[model samples]
Target: MLPARHAAPLQKGLLLALLLSLAACGGGGGGDSSSPADPGTTVPTPTPPSGLTPPSEADAQRFLSQATFGPTQANIDSLRTVGFKPWLASQFQAKGNLYSTGYSDAIHKAGLKDFCKQFSGFPNDYARNNCWREYYSAEPLSREFYRNALYGPDQLRQRAALALSQLFVVSNAEVEGTYGLREYQQMLADKAFGNFRDLLKSVTLSPVMGTYLNLVNNSKADPNENFARELLQLFSIGPCQLNADGTLPGGQCVATYDNNGVRDVAFALTGWTYPAGGVSPWGSSGWKNPTYLRGQMLAVAAEHDQTERKLPGGGTLAASRTPEQALDAVIDALYQHPNLPPFIGKQLIQHLVTSNPSPAYVARVSQAFVSGKAYDFGSGVRGDMQALFAAILLDPEARGDNKNSDPNYGRLREPAQYIAGMLRALNASSDGANFYWWWGNELGQIVFNANSVFNFYPPDYPLPGTDVVGPAFAIENANSTLARLNLATAMLYWGGLQAEDDRPGATGTQINGSNWLALADNPTLLVDSLDKVLVTGGLPANIKTGIVDAVGVWNEKNHGATWREERARSAVYLVLASPEYQVQR
Candidate 1:
């Protein structure tokens, strides 16, 4: 970008400097001077000026591990040297979308050209509609999703989109082949840090959501209450009437909206359908012979209901309202509802930080959502996702390592997250095709393949033997728990490739323990490194002893060629299976 004249001089200066350096080195000037290195690395474990100490590399790793898919050495080093806020700023600056910014190469590499082949041969509507699921949504796109989660720069956006996906609740299980689902998830990532109002509007119009919620092709005369009920009960506001701190009065939960409200809301949301032919601006001819989904659902004016629509605070929408105007009015009402800020804030906090945030924690995040640092919506808008998420992550309660007094502090590492964290931490090799999708199927929770609109689990799902909110516990039954343990064992020990029956010759994805093998001579250092990577220094003393003992036994048994591999593999498998790694505190 330099001007021609300036570029010529700069190039000359660079060449002159390079020649001088070469001559000086050859002349043996013996200059032992290395200019002071820039921080965030030079000082391997510097204390922060902010006075809140991360203290150790493991501590630093723990923070980033919680915030991201997994912590890399570089991330841990940076956080250890610079502390939390500066590292956060750098991460925020490196944001890019998973589905939008770069994915063509990944898709092409999967050998799925023309994934949407315009199939109309299947007898049933479900099969015919979902034939594309294998390539577009299931395999190829799943590869891209893996690529982004493992190596993408937009970690915060990916995490936020993940949280939003659970709330919005569109799944591949229902839609089959998932072209629209991909677009819908991308939209969530794109809008992850924008205004919540805009995010809700985009979700409302997404064809994937419309199809899943039965809102697309909806008419005023025969309205489907699915999307509308969820929009209030699940997506925006909670099921019950809530106070500012997201608490019910007198231990009693009251419904926020009755069936009548759902009916009215469905009436307002009607007459929107997918744009045909992978076209934008909606309602194009391509909708007849869909190539792939592109833009959101567009409204059909003739099918829209213009009857008096109910708004929050007993306000009624204009009787002659257009579809867009009516939808906008409803979104406005949802945004302004007193319950929305706290309701959404509580869930987001649960999603990102703690499963059981104190009312004070909810209140702080709620205030940020209600009165954001700035008004993001065009005019008179109140919610800002950027401010709200930052509040959730950086809140004092979220940041502190409080496990002694607060036993119900952290969330269980959900199946998808548990796999992702381990996969990323170890820098494992994956073709990004079969392993992730297979894992999703093996575990009950797939990334976008949650079976229904209620999501993989509810927020208030209770822990066994207690009334404590244990959301991930809902998925943890006897069989599923065994699956989690066995799957972790398979991935670390054998890389999820079944030896005899499941693809005997094909090794899907393998975890390389050559690096871990190098450190296996010393059990303390080996356990420490693995512990830091997997549990962030919180590996239980008993688990450590057991793994160390197991590795020692493996060394004794496999005194031959596989001892090194056995040592490393045993350590990873045992650590991952430990209760310490299962529930991330």
Candidate 2:
């Protein structure tokens, strides 16, 4: 029999029900868009493109699992029939989804007007109201994200938005109570499939980015270097020159900029501030209303630094004398840097497909980021977003591994990915809003709520078993592993997560196990089907045998009211808890 979820203290930073608001996520934001078609309520098989050879059913399931949130049977069938290219094209055509409700709903929930104003003269009204907007924007946005990833058809855009979120990081932890944090996330989503250069500028101007990085009200009198440093180091061109394959040239990396260069970039970034009065829909919350975050900060010409400056990689900003011009020059220079291509290319591949992508794989993606120009969504004439992403997914290295297994090819799925994949695979239903799961307590990652600019972990985190870098492993420890086990066990048998808060509540999410129980009698068949959704067919044969043997012990006579269901739950719980399903290949 399978052991039950431990009766131990629950993890911290957890809430009973998921806090969902109308907001944005990395893959959900307004940055990039795929198709014009909406993700209709029901998911149906797409019309397979003619004259294209589809991948095998197993291969299709494997690819879809990695590419989307998790593979749906309908989507899996569609991918196999349409082939990779057409399937991708169809995904590109899917439209983005946003909150169905308004920001006012959040304020209404706080009920400040009825209770506080009626009872007492509230001095902390500013702080009070700000909390409402931020609270609603934060978790509710994640619910929307999960809904889309699990059921929405815009899988590619969602994946791209997630990848962009990691790169251009802005956490709800940092920018709460400001202009709907959703806009910042939407900015990244809107640009995920757009030009990288455009994404950088948009992020630089975003209110959420400004708050997170302290760049919104940046001034030349005493410049803030935080955003500038991260912009060059993390977002645009990295500090070191990565070779085409993403390794140091001859194992001796070269620096692109020095201290003076960083300062110059900082000085160049000055002259922007939150909207005037700060209380308007899109500016910094002001002295009048200090708590509310406003819209994207606007550039102030008077505050601009009009001095000579040195550009990164040996250039002068002589031509860029104004704030906007200077900022544009800086962005263009950073985008064109040779390092930007491979630096971002490798990380993008790591994020979407595998952790330790081969140098050849890195090079292939790098080329796409640089030279691929087959398709364009009309954002700009330069660097087609569609082309860049298509290269990463359709490349021989990324897809070829699906045909031939590479022992060292997969990534350990991050906590959020693990939780999300489970929900998506099981086809869990939710209200789309107020859907909540305390992933941070168990997995150390909440939707858009990273603690720092570094994101959940450093991209170059080295795996414990090997010296190879694996970003997702940074959160992988005994405690978290145990937490994952607890979560898997609870999800399988307990219906879903419990509200860690004082009040009793639903997981804001639950899956119908009827389909699961149908195949409970044959452990092999049951396990194989789940493997496609959970592990993408990476479960080793020996591990499969172990799981089959372990789950077979639960039978009708020994199990509960829904004996077949209990057996199925036991099988899924074991597989989900196993080390085999934790990593993604």
Candidate 3:
């Protein structure tokens, strides 16, 4: 870490540069809008634009910025060679990274005393803390998440699963363990490219989500409305009535449901309990069965409320139906809601592409979600995620030659994306066992540890001093902005984290400045090359000139033996810390 004293001057300089850059570029923000028509309006299919003829390296990087954690030279090469559709096909079929939820469960079964015995050198207090982190807490799981993001082959799936996790929010704050959390995330990854309905069902039945949303042992006498309300508010059809294109009617929001509706859904969804297995290490099972995270939550008929309830799209959930049947109805109602396609589509667009997509863009994706079928790897179903993802990524708004021209077309890089982008652009190497995961807390988006169900930032959060809404900017403040620059300085100038025996797997995260020494001799070439990799649409001429001039100062004759390395590091550090690179277009 860079010292506070050193960081102060650097922070001021970088902040001034960022403000100037932002002034030059424009403010960043977004909004939700679609169609003025009814929910069932069948939008005309958008024409598929022709692929880029021999895609440019910058274009490939931009696409990968949206589709994957970050882009690499190899991935850019592959995309440039085969083009977009074929590359997407390969990614869809590629094997995904597997989480070790089962292993975590095994660790839990063995008890904390036996599990902590592996570590030889540690204080007495260290044993329990270490054991809890490895076996029960979210530490190990977070490592696995970052590990896959850095090195996994199935990049699109990883990105998509991450997007899904935020929408169907669950946090380690409540469900504190590796087993259920990993299982919930794995379910998301597995079903990421599958049907949206199936993914919804899996999330609903997931013990992890159940625990988080208070859906585990819902009582018939008095129902809890936490999951039911969020199901309508955040997960599925948002609290407002939306058109087929996701726009609010009459240029104003309308309530989708009331408190009564929440109670009705909650009562309908009663009578579920944890799966049958695993001893609760904490020794408590008063309201429900002992904690179990392996299988789906089981139904308990005795605890079920058999009262008739109203569904989302104006349908009656019969009182005669079983708890399982009522659940099926609830899932069906949510899946079939017109707001689902655009609501989900727009958010996915925000996550992957620009924050403020045009209503026409949302309409096109919504149409694909409603009517488009996935012939590649799906069963040609209506709610096909494969088809949905294709619509979002391959849309005319997402691709083509007009990305950088529009002043308002981009998102502020969330901490996670910022770190990943910096590392991937520089050809950084790591085993994913480093301080990067812990740095998430510092950067304000810890993986599985969101402050609440609202996530690290609200999806529609407005950019301060701007009318537009940039979700990631919700975490962008003076402190975080400085922290970002300091991190860049530490990684580039001072050495990044070194591999040590204390860390799991003894693996470090690093980028080699020496590798860029060849290009560093020529400042213009070095700056241009780094810009192509790190900045979408390349850097502004002024910014590029400034960096090139700065890099040129470190000459072989005057700056001595470390001149080349310093030049390279300086070039990287300047670009990464620039406002030009912070807002991804």
Candidate 4:
């Protein structure tokens, strides 16, 4: 028997807001400010390119693909009202106001300050306080490390998200802090829309990068090769061979670099270390101090390797590659390479939009990454975020021809999206850690806890002839599928609809249980709600029908019973479990 999976923690403030918002609409009788427009409610439809009164399904799909997680009735209506180009512009230049609900803000405010403060200790102090406990306990040091790293830190989420994003842009050395603290998360976010080269530099010095890549402890005599190896293989100048069109040549695979090249890069990476000691005449010890470092990576002179090194391709450089020199060489090497664009662009596209980007798609996006032609910045063409977004959304590959037809060319929904959507739909709170714990257990993917630097799964690991991507594919097997179904069932029936008292701290007070039933009683409305919150605004007819039928059956079976809420809940469960909802597009 396998262990039971769990759901993500719900936010109390969000749930309360949902309840109040719903009640203000007179018990779901009418649409409130947050309530999405009805699917059947007709308005003056726009004349799309085809001169059709309403936007084509492809247009709808494209809008959904680019704008939100997935399409929902509300999103579609907004698209219809605002038009695609305008909406695209807004999404590209999103402000804090884009989110109508305050859930994200609430989550951010919950304990971010405390989290940051806990990790703000001096590096030496931190090591002294917890290093012993970490060594003696059976629990892994990573757990304690993160606990200290993030506890009392209001910027935990932002820091984590930025680090995860940086895995895409920067070279390993720079990321490992061969650079300095110049590259923290806030700086990354602020400069996210700027030059790719700067972003790369920032990533290199980010404390997170230093800690994660082990650059903090890298020294002159024994330079750690982890950052050096990944720098070439994963970050830039990836595996061998390229097409004339600058794409990966057909049948060509990522080749391993000669050991000499690795050694040279490693040598270049030497000398950088976190600031140590207290903030005094000298700078604070880099992230390595672990006490006052606040988990940020910094360059430490003592730990840096100053040895001369030979390149794998037969070149020899003088001993002592300064951090700046190493960064310049590595960045230039990667920037000049033909493979960088396709390699990095492919990953970005997969993460942001789709998994199976076509070859043409890869070519176009890669071009933008290199030269920034389609969305390129000025002469010094670096990977600009605005350009990247344009390439992702406006590219011919992204707006596939299917949009004119069925418009189904989208990537699969990641587990994070699935869990978040369910929470929003259920209007539950993580008051007692129910939601977060549940999701961490069942989804096989957790926020801030990636299985490896490679991420939850590779975008194209399972080559046409290979089976290396087994773990990625297996996430959707029968057992996992059943778990998903069970999750949905629990949320709809026994999960969200239960009286507040049935939960850990409820005082048996029947607090607004009818909202759950009201949601179930109207299948169209229920599916529509899900469409808005979970799928964005693009529920297929088949999915809608299945949900309605499931809810109807459950409702009929339990009609006149006190547990009507459970029946309504069953409907939502069925909908979430559907294959249509599972796929991201």
Instruction: Give lDDT: candidate 1, residue 400.
Output: 45
Candidate 3 at residue 69, lDDT?
84
Clashes of 2: 26
Q: What is the lDDT of every predicted structure here?
A: 0.65, 0.64, 0.75, 0.46
Question: Over the stretch 161-196, how does candidate 2's per-residue lDDT look in tens digits?
Answer: 888898888887766542356776666667776677
Candidate number with greatest lDDT:
3
Consecutive 10-residue window with the lowest summed lDDT within model 4 = 24-33
Give the local distance difference test score of model 4: 0.46
State the lDDT of candidate 3 residue by residue for 1-585, as single tens digits: 211112213633768768556544433323334445567777665544535476667667788888988876677788889988888888888785657533556544543434566544344554455666655666666667666777788989988988888899898877766777888888888988888888888888888888899988888999789999999888888888877776887879888888888898899889888887755455335547766787799898888888888998789999888889999999999998888888888889889888777777777788788875522424566788888888887776776555666677777777878877777776667665543355777788877778899888887887666676788877777777777887787677656756755444556777755546678779998888777677765577887898889889888799787777778877878888887688787
Full candidate order by TM-score, most accurate first: 3, 2, 1, 4
Better of 2 and 4 by TM-score: 2
Q: Give the best candidate by TM-score.
A: 3
Rank order (by lDDT, best first): 3, 1, 2, 4
Residue 498 Cα positional deviation in candidate 2, in Å, after optimal superposition: 5.5
Q: Estimate each model's TM-score.
A: 0.79, 0.82, 0.92, 0.65
Candidate 4 per-residue C-alpha lDDT over 1-585 given as tens digits, one digit per residue, 9 for 90 to 100: 011124423323533432232122111001011221221222221122422235544455554544343444445576667655555555444432110111111111222233223433324654345432222221222222222222212121222233344354322222222112222333554555566676666656554565567655566677788777777777766656554223443555546376668777876776665544323223224434532233334565556555666543234555555566666666666665666666667666665555555555566666666655453222336576556556655554454334312232444555555554454344434322222235444756543345466655655544233322222343444455455555555554343323333222322111122445666657667666655445445556765775666556654555555334544555455556554456544
Candidate 4: where is the Cα deviation over 4 Å?
A: 1-72, 95-188, 244-247, 254-256, 276-321, 373-380, 400-408, 425-437, 463-479, 495-547, 554-558, 561-568
